[model samples]
Target: MRVRKLTFAALAVAAGLSLTACNGDDGTAQSDGSSSSSSSTSGGGSGSGGSEQGGGKDDSAGKSSAGSGSDAQAKAAKCRTDDLDITAKDSTIDGDDEGTVAVEFKNGGGRDCLLSGYAGVDLKTSEGDLSAERSGQESSPMVLKDGESVFFGVTYPLNESGGSGVKVSSLVITPPNETKSFSVEWPGAATLPVTDGSGSSVKVGPMGSAGQGGAS
Candidate 1:
């Protein structure tokens, strides 16, 4: 009876050891699975972040390219006459209608340009109606290179109705083969004094003013 009881106690001890070993193995497997799941989640998050960054860069590049294209189109659509710079020194002329008025033009562009014709002038009276003056066709073809200049002399007939100073309202410069028309205004012609003087003392009317002793 004593031996049988001893044998039963030994079997109980062995069963307890076996249970402990099985529990340890299960804990280690659970820990390893959890670690693997965490690593996978972190790796997936990193990959998504990288893709988002790359997509943002591509979008920015597309916008930049579109802007560049727009700018290029604007430059291409710009008229050649737009590049010309014209300045008149004393554009107003105060003289007998029988004489000529000279206008000087300077080209400020980097390339060459052509002047084809002038614009019509409209003369108005402060009190009544008057006829308009037409600028004659450009007699010779004029070309102005970069930093070059040319002078144009326009002559008109002096008549009795032209008295009280004529107003030169507008000057138009037309370029060859160009559809755009460039215009310069003479608002100062409104104040030109009428007198009979020659040489430098001769007072030229403002661009908006008529010749000496012409109708406003």
Candidate 2:
């Protein structure tokens, strides 16, 4: 009877130890699960920070694009006739009877502006006004700051022989994209005759930075 009681006590002790071991294993599993959950939460926070960084980059790019649009909107205005100091002179080729009336435009304003296209020219004669034709050169926009200058030409044949021509006395000049007109006397008005019987021979060229035929 004493041996049987001792055997039964030993079995009970072993069962208790086994149950404790199982509880310990379950606790270890719970700890590992908690660690995994914490790691997952930490990874989620890191991903949120990355999203915020990307958002910041997007905002910066948006501001840069807006600034570029503003810069594009700040282009210069068209040059007005009141902003120019204009002069005209005769440009006779050495041997050819073909001649040019070089019209120089100086920007005398305080701000920068744009100059483009042909100068509206009308040759005033005794019979009637002869309007000059365009020379078919491409007119490009050019910026003219204060004190800058550009030139255009009024080309016509001298018609030294008594032929189909008109004797020009004065010129009515109009700058491009403007309504105001200014007058300058035709250089050598008494001697030179512009052959414009069809009224299409006298031609006006495009504006240039260098001189006549220097349009760009």
Candidate 3:
């Protein structure tokens, strides 16, 4: 009877040990599953943060591109005297005692420019130098592109009465807002006096875009 009691106790202890080993294996499997799940969640969070940071960099680059474009389209500059090619022509009407000379200012440079106001004129004569007066005409600013031209008028009374008058030999012209001057031969008839009597009645009109009118 004692031998049978010992065998039963050994069987009960063996069954208890097998149950404890199975419980330990189940706990280990559960812990491995939880660790894998936490690792996957951490990887997903890292990918999302990387995408947000990349998007912020792209936005900053776009803003920088827009600012550079604005700087490229800035305002234009004013015109200078070195950008022009000036010349003169006779524009007197037929059978009229009053004479007119059209002075054209052509833009010969590679860019656009602004031209306004009257051109200064001085007539070289045998008696003395005669300065032309402004005709008190209103003028607007003119924008001359490359190869474009603007005009102004010089009006004077002709010495058609065959009386003694001052003969103008040459013309000294100065562009508006400029200190330098240009001298050119008289464009009218060589023998004709440019003005009547003492030659103090010469006047210079305002700048114009058209060939006929003085200012427009």
RMSD of each: 13.2, 5.0, 5.4
Better of 1 and 3 by TM-score: 3
Give the alpha-carbon lDDT of every model.
0.51, 0.80, 0.77
Residue 29 local lDDT, model 3:
100
- Tens-digit lDDT string for candidate 1 (1-216): 999999999999999999999999999999999999999978888788999999999999999898788565522222256665643333335554454444444566666665544423222334322323444332444555667555544444443455666444554544335667566653233423343433221222223232322221
Please report the TM-score between candidate 3 and the true structure: 0.60
Location of the lowest summed lDDT over 10 successive residues in candidate 1? 199-208
How far residue 55's Cα lies from its native spot in candidate 1, in Å, is: 4.5
Mind sharing the TM-score for model 1? 0.38
> Model 1 segments beyond 4 Å from truth?
45-47, 50-58, 61-70, 76-155, 158-216
Residue 200, candidate 2: Cα error in Å is 3.5
Best-to-worst lDDT order: 2, 3, 1
Give the per-residue lDDT of model 3 (tens digit) for 1-216: 999999999999999999999999999999999999999978788788999999999999999898889676645345566777877887777886777788878888788877767778988877778889998889877777888888888877776767566677887888887878888777754434544456468888888823845322
Candidate 2 ranges with C-alpha deviation above 4 Å: 1-44, 65-73, 159-167, 191-196, 209-216
Q: Which stretches of model 3 miss by more than 4 angstroms?
A: 1-76, 189-199, 209-216
